[model samples]
Target: MIRHLSSLIMDNVSNVKSFVLLGFNDTMNFRVPLFIITLLHYCVILFFNISLVLLIVLDESLHEPMYIFLSSFCINALYGSTGFYPKFLSDLLSSFHHISYEGCMLQAFIMYSFSSCDLSILAVMAFDRYLAICRPLHYHSFMTMRRLSQLVCLSWLTPFCIFSINIPITSRVKLCGINIQRVLCPDWLIVKLACPEVKSNLTLIVYIFHGFFIIWIYTHLIKTCMRSSEDRVKFMQTCVPHLTSLIIFLFVMVFQSIYGRFDSTDSSRIFQNLIAIELLTILPVMNPLIYGFKLTKIRNRILTSVYLNRK
Candidate 1:
């Protein structure tokens, strides 16, 4: 019996060219319908993000530092959606499950790089709002077009730099015995699969350190906003979306870290399932809704733009 069981396990391993993505397996019967839904969501996010980005670029009235950073977020979302949903949509519609190892790595790199860039841009936006609200008198001079351009450039550049260093180092290592569990390879999960000697390549000490700086700056910005009684409404209105996104991101990261320490058992499988779907699929869908629609100004701008374009 023991020999038979061992043989069965080996046979299963040998025959398994790729692991089935049980991530969205819950929607098994509704794959086509779910694809349509994902398509609609992706279209809405793309339209709104591009519309806002165009509005900022074309309308002089919307060219402040706040709008500048908002446009950056839109661009990030545009690329981020492409990084994730294209493959997801394809997988759902045709039930295409096999992604080459290279393709999976590319997807992970693009997804993580875009997400990290979005975080940095949001931090910059928070700082912009902080200075504008806290120092109204000098807001214009301090956040001039040139300075805003520099900040935006830095925000975009920093993520690529970090990813360029970390992704190649981590992804180049072998994963001989590891099994990919989903339709996509998560960058961090790929790292975890690496053998011990090559593990240091995946240790993102610098990324973690910079992430803390972003959090610290954002914390100060939040405190500044809370302290100003006269500018309270405006501060909160501008800062709340950023604060919410940041909070949710940090919460997910914390949960992922804690869950990652557990044995690879049933509970870990549940955590993995939740993380794969929510973090990769749902988060991108929710991001534009949270940051764009919930804001009265952006909501109106998007509606007005769509109406005008239609006419």
Candidate 2:
């Protein structure tokens, strides 16, 4: 019985093309206000992420491997926001509800590509921090500019290569039957709709997305806690921000996974929508807040820049 069910899900479609996304809802009631709110949030995030990246790149003071990784993630964040926001803004202002199949696929690909890059970069940043704090002697030689540049390139390239393989698999399957139900046609939801031998894709994605990141971050974190003899206040200051970000990500992922698995129903659908908004909108707002307020370097940079401008 299990085998048969697996076969049913795993079979690849031979023919058919294109999909029509149902998209959150067709109601006129909530579209305009939601659109405006989403636009404002995305603009702020884009500006912050891009400005930070530029500042890191231009400022010789911020030229370390740590800042390099942060800049790379900032670029990914910009790409991530770009993939989803323009469509959302258009949908809100113009009431353009339809997306071409090509458009949807491209959107899904870009979103996940950036997201995957960000995830890997975050892991790399954590490792960089571990090396700096826990193994300070080796940090300079180990994380040089040349090496950091290579790592940044790899972080960007890795997702493009992996997603290129998986996207072709998705392209082979037709989306004629299933309808997407979100403002952004997220890759996860799109893959679920594509009738492919999807176990391989799902398994790979889970490994990359969930498995690697969770293990990598926490493992280093445990090592840091064990080794650090620093004052409690100093230790907690760094630990708390990363810990909070991780908790929020885990909570959202857990709920979203459960919501994805549930049968298509109104209540389940509502829960998923709520989760999506929080993941996209609320999290971006919190990220800058966490990093800006918690990290001394970032806080001092902002204050110094402000003071210098005034002078």
Candidate 3:
């Protein structure tokens, strides 16, 4: 029996090419409907995000700091959505829901970094709004195009570099199992599949540092917005949309995190899948919608472009 088990283990090591995603319930009769719903979700995500990104790029009139940041936000939405949706939708329709080891790592990298970068961009936007509202005279001086470009790059690159830490750690691990419990490769899920020695302290500190930085930025924005009625209006006008998006993103992240860690009971698979996917499904739509409708210049530009295209 001991020799047989050893052979089995060696066979698994040699033959394990992909992981089975156990998030879907094979007994469920709604796979077709589920596929349709997920397909529409992807379509909406692509429509809104790509439209806004094009709007920002084409309209030189909207080339200010806020719009530029909004463009970055939309692009990241596309990035995140693409990471999840294509594979997810395909899995929903397929008989076998499996992802290769390399594919799983890539998905986790994109998904995690997309989220972290979203938070980073939001933090930068919050700071920019604070400067524009509270220190109006110096806003232009401080947020010059060159500096704004640098901030944009920081927002994009910082999270990419931070999340890349996990890839090496995960790669070094000798995975014991070839089953991932989620539809997509979330970092935590991927990490869990690895051997026990992968210390998560560094990743934890990176997350904590990111959270604190975002909180600190918002704290200053709140303090500054308190002083003047005019600044209050600016905050309500611009920051409110950002605040709304931030709250939703944070809520989705927290909800998913909780469910991922604690909820192990054999419950509803559909509900499980929904919670796992809420962030990717929700944010791509929410970010572009909030910025598109709430920000006057973007709205107007979109309208003007639409009207002109009709002509």
Candidate 4:
């Protein structure tokens, strides 16, 4: 009887070739407007992130550890946004909101890696700030070009590798359902469709560890800044943007998590959809604006370039 049931489960899993995203079901009347709005938003994300990345790469005066990390952050934002927006915009116009099994897995992988990479990069930025402020004399010796390259690579690669393992495990699961309630396929939602129990504890543990590490680093930063006005000024200029990005990220993530746990029927579907896409929409636009205006070096370089181009 167990063997027969297992075969039935396998057969059912084989049958689920695509997932219907019900998040857009209620938006029939507003699809055109949503499409235009989302398109403009996506364009802004691309423009802001890409322009920042280019500005960093082209300008030699901005070649510092902090700016480099900021460039990486912008690039990751672009990477994550690209994974979602094209398909999203396409779906907004199409009558059917279907994603292939492979497409769903790929989207989930991109998003998971993107999120993990964000935390990792932010943690590295916090560490960089800690070193710059707390150990100013040792900062140069500790954060050499080679070391900076390694940190950037690890920040991007580690998350990709971790999620590479995760997506395959998810692929192997016997799925009993073909409907994903969200606008995009997140790993947890995929796990939710599985016939048997599956736990993504590793992601949670990694995120929690990064969170605590950033907090610990900031605690030391606060104490150090309290003693020296110079250090305090540095903190306000550099760490403020990092902290703002972190806060925005954490807020969106926490809201999404809390919203996911509650019954979907409790909230309006439009509100649910908004919550679902906030991470992609908010962070990409906000981070660049925050850093572009907040960092004196970057801000000045941008103005100089704009003034030169206008001439």
Q: In TM-score terms, which candidate is top?
A: 4
What is the C-alpha lDDT profile of model 4 across 127-200, one tens digit per residue? Answer: 99999999999999999999999999989988888888888988998888777777899888888887775777
Name the top lDDT candidate.
4
> How does model 1 fare in lDDT?
0.68
What lDDT tens digits, residue by residue, belong to model 2 across residues 161-240?
88887777676665434356766676667666655425445424643564466577667666666665572354476656
Please give each candidate's TM-score. Answer: 0.79, 0.82, 0.90, 0.94
Off by over 4 Å in 3: 1-10, 13-16, 197-199, 306-311
In the range 1-311, model 3's lDDT, one tens digit per residue, is 32443355557653445677877645247878888887887898889988888888888888999989998998898888888888887877776667887898898889888888888888888888878876789999999889999999999998888778767777667766666666777767766766563446665566667678778877887888798787788888899899999889878877877787787758676677678778887889888888888998988887887999999
Comparing candidate 1 with candidate 3, which one achieves the higher lDDT?
A: 3
Is 1 or 2 the stronger prediction by lDDT?
1
lDDT of 3 at 219: 87
Stretches of model 4 off by over 4 angstroms after superposition: 1-11
Ranking by lDDT: 4, 3, 1, 2
Measure candidate 1: CA RMSD: 5.0
Model 3 TM-score (2 dp) = 0.90
Clashing pairs in 2: none
Q: lDDT scores for all predictions?
A: 0.68, 0.66, 0.80, 0.89
Order the candidates by TM-score, highest first.
Answer: 4, 3, 2, 1
Candidate 3 Cα lDDT to native:
0.80
What's the TM for model 1? 0.79
Q: Candidate 3: worst 10 consecutive residues by lDDT?
A: 1-10
